[model samples]
Target: MSSAVLHRDTRFVPKKAIGGQGCYINLEDGTKFLDSTGGAAVSCLGHGNEKVNRMIKDQLDQLAYCHSAFFGTQVSEDLASFLTESTGGKLSKLFVVSSGSEAIEAALKLARQYFLELPTPQDQRTRFIARLPSYHGTTLGALGAGGHVLRRQPFEPLLAKNTSHVSPCYAYRGKKDRESDADYVARLATELDAEFQRVGPESVCAFIAEPVVGAALGCVPAVPGYFPAMKAVCERYGALFILDEIMSGMGRCGTLHAWEQEGVVPDIQTIGKGLGGGYAPVSGILINDSIVQAMDKGSGVFRHGQTYQGHPISCAAALAVQKTIKEDSLLENVRTMGAYLESQLRQTFENHPYVGDIRGKGLFWGVRITWAVWAETFTDLYMQLEFVKDRTTKEPFDPQDRLSFLIQEKGLQPEFAVSLYGSPGTVDGIRGDHVVLAPPYIVSKEEIDTIVNVMTRVLAEVFAELGV
Candidate 1:
């Protein structure tokens, strides 16, 4: 038999997900898997949401697609309005797109365009400064703006040199034991300032950062005062502060906009995943009033656009998702449930010998596993599993060991039947390993407990089996 699809790992064929409801996904072969991370934190409302599905169907029945350049749809306009208003009009204009990558692509272009639209056009401002352990997207432009080392390595030659990176605000590994939170923030701020100076501040367009570090670094939130410090540097350099809330925004971090908690407003922002709640492929860029006015007074046009830029059905679905979140007062639930999750995690993993750090906000949490410690703490388990070589000095197992991948896979076994989102290279973009969990905003306390219990069991079994 021949297959038309090209899988991520050709050797490992994945089971089909036939259906999903709430937090569980049913596989083709009848296995029910509780999704703890919502497939990279995309499914905020969880699978099979009736309201979202109905909205999609209603929109489809009315109208679906049209060229945005020639037509404006009510659903698209409403979603754009809702999103801009959600930011208290700080982000004055919205450009809807199909995915997070495209939203970021729009942001990159708009940043350059914003500079160009200035009274004294900053035509030389072409570069972007992002942070390491960052993942903006996979498209060439977005890829260049990201600093996920391993992902960028193979594509280095193909990627543009328009973006540079600084250290991410990862307190677990980046902060020193003797350093205070303020001092750590100051140090990271200094690093950003120096990078801007090194890159020639005058020529830079923006400093792009995830409000909360997402996949590349697990779910690391910046230390207090970090964003304000970073924003100060960008402002001093006349650079726009671009916050990538693609994974951590839209109530994922207990707030609609992650920056709200940081007490900073970005000049530009990109959001996805939770926006459409995995009901539709929708993402968008929200431009500040200043930038929008500059463009309005100047060329009155953004040079870039997509054919499916605000597809009617996509916007309708997203609008419904947002409405449901608001009407149900789910952000309150995120706060309530998020606190519960944090407590549960601390209770479960705080003293686990191999669990080095547990950090995050709201529902977005990361568990940093010290694999070397894993071999030491569970000598018998290590002997039975026997994947890594060294058990001391914090040395990671060989890349071939694929510890993170193995744990992700192992979480789905029959005994546990739970799912987790795992990523490697948390330490430097190639060595450290961590697991991220972003349960649905609607997750119940009972469900949260179940997720924790299932995850704990899965971890134990993975250590014993080296596979999920």
Candidate 2:
């Protein structure tokens, strides 16, 4: 009856996801799964959005495909204007791309170009600094900037060597127990300063990060004063600040933009996932006036683009999605529902011995399983880390040893999926294992409760089986 290629654990065929509505994905087999992660936090407006679909249809009716160079479309500019307006108009330019990875690649290259835009001989700087356990994207350039050891393994040689990482603002595992948030933040900032010094500050072009550590740390929001400290350090080194909001922005968090909560703005910001609300594949980078002015003064051309750059229909869909969010005030909904989700998860999993942590902002949240469960399942992950020595040379069954894979499989069950929003958990600071949750902007209290209930059951089931 069906002959189409499929992926991801062929042992269990996923029911064909033919459609979606609000927080639920509909299958051709008449099954529905709650979209807790909003398809990797992309579907902010949820699915089957009549307004976005209408806009796409309207744009397609007028023009389907137009090369973005010679002819700039009204829809793209309008979408850009909306984004700039939403972001407080600090950003002057928006370069639309097709996906988050491409957006990140563009942002990285843009930072390099911006430095070259400097007229002085100091413009040759091409170095970038990021944090460990932070993921930028999947493409070579983005992955190069990303510090995830597991994702960077096979192509490690191909990645740009100019990019290096400092310690993430992660406090749970890395922060000393005795350290206050302020002191811990200062320590991280000091490390960053040292890195800048090590790299010879002038040679570094940008300091990049996911405002909230996503995917790599189970939605680990930085400790207090972290962003402000990092921002100050970046400015001290005269490096551009590039914040990746692809996963945490677009109202996945309670704030319309996660950076709004972070209390610092970036010279360049990349966003996706929620922008088009899964109605279309669209992601873009927002440029502050400084970067734009630098380009104007120097290399006037970004020299980077895609065939689908600022696709008219994609822009139209995103614009409509944005409009709907604004008109309906979905971000307010996110804040309200996010609080409810947090309370539900905390109530359900906080005391559970196996569920180690529950942390996030807005609707984007995560649950981490204890390291005790790691040794039993997903043990192969240990060998994947390049830095770790297989001390089968008399290694103990350390909980840390089993943490990564244990956290991953712990979330998967017959009912729901977490970490679908757009985060991976951290293990020994590298391998992915934590589960993230990113429900839609339109999620209800009932739906949030259901998600928590299902998640609790999954954690219980996994832990009980492990005898934890």
Candidate 3:
């Protein structure tokens, strides 16, 4: 058989997903796989949700699409109101887009436009500061503002030159032993301040970061007081503080917003994935009242436009998704199940020889694989186990092994039948491997048990096959 569609990996064809229901997906060959990662943590509400389906159908009957330039749809307006109100009026405006990448593009443009719309028009502000090993999106603007190493490598020349990178607040491999969290935070803050000073603080436009880093760092959250301190540094330079919650927000981290747990509000926040629970292609940016006021008082319009910016069907679906989350009180379940999942993971793998770190919040979790061994010299044992030769050093596996991808492939076998989001380059941008598990909010205890059990077997098999 042949395929016409150009897949992400041109060399291989993927299995056909014929249908999805609840927490599982059915392939054309009759194999059912547990969708533990929810297709990159997008399907928060699970699949085959009748309530959301009905809403989309109803919206199609009423209206499907509308250009934002001429008229606005009620569904779009309602979705915006729902989002803004959810923030308790902290973010007074919303700019709808079709994907996380689009949302990031919009946020970047809005932040730049905001400075231009200010009373004095700080046109000198041009640069953006973002953390390394971060994933924002694939678009050039978003890629420029992000620090994902491999993603930016091919298109380095095309990316915007106004952005710079800084070290992430990664406590696992970053925080020194015996270093207090406060001291680590202070050091990060100092580093940020130095970057600003080096880049000329007056020329900086914003400092963008993920509330909880997504694929690049594999669900790494900043230590307590990290966000506040970083935000304070941004304030010192009068630059906007932008949070990319594309993978960690919208109840994915046990709260409606990941920042709710961090005790800081970003000047601009981009959200996606779970925003519409994968029912529709939708993402958006929430803007602070100050930025909205500046734009409203000046240009009176954002200098950006997309043909499908506020598609009615997308908004209707998103509205239903948000309504269901609130009406069903699913956030409570997220907290409960998240805790259960955490306990289960720790109990199962806390002492595993190959598992290096297990970190996450809410439903999003990452298990990093590192084979640490105490040996006098490199020998057969070292050749057999490739991951971090020494755990104390927190070293990473060779990128050539593709260990995470191997685990992902093993998990998809009928014997395992589980889908885990596996990624590499966790340590720097090209040297580590980890697998993320983000089941739908509707996942039950039994389902979680199955996920863990399957992962346990899959990992054991992988290690045994490697003769580690």
- The lDDT per prediction is 0.82, 0.73, 0.85
The local distance difference test score of model 3 is 0.85
Q: What ranges in model 3 sit over 4 Å off?
A: 372-389
Instruction: Using TM-score as the measure, name the better of candidate 1 and candidate 2.
Output: 1
Judged by whole-model lDDT over C-alpha atoms, candidate 1 comes out at 0.82
Sort every candidate by TM-score, greatest first: 3, 1, 2
Q: All candidates' TM-scores?
A: 0.94, 0.89, 0.96
For 1-468, candidate 1 gives per-residue lDDT tens digits of 345678897766788899999988999889988887878788889999898899999999999889999999999888988988998878888899999999999999999999899999989999999998799999989999999998899999999998988998876567786899899999889999999899899999999999778878877777779999999999999999999999999988888888998999999999999999889899998889999899999999999989999999889989999999999998888888887887777678766655666777778887777743321110000001111222344454456567778778888776677777778887778887778888888788888789778878767876666442
Assess candidate 2 and give its lDDT.
0.73
Question: Which candidate number maximizes TM-score?
Answer: 3
Cα lDDT of model 2 by residue, 1-468, tens digit: 343556565565655778777777777766677777776767787788888888999999998879987789999989999999888888888999999999999998888887777766366587999988678899999999888877888998898899989888765457785888899988898999999999899899889998766776757677767888888998987788998988887777666677887789889999998888888889999999998988898868889978999999889988999899999988888877777777676666555544455677777777555432211011000001111112222111234445434434554433554423322336554433456777788888887777767765665565456564
Candidate with better TM-score, 2 vs 3: 3
* Winning candidate number (lDDT): 3
For candidate 1, what is the total of clashing residue pairs?
3
Residue-pair clashes, model 2: 8
**Candidate 3 lDDT, tens digit per residue, 318-411?**
8999999999988888888887887787778767777777778888887777754222110000001123534666567778877888898999
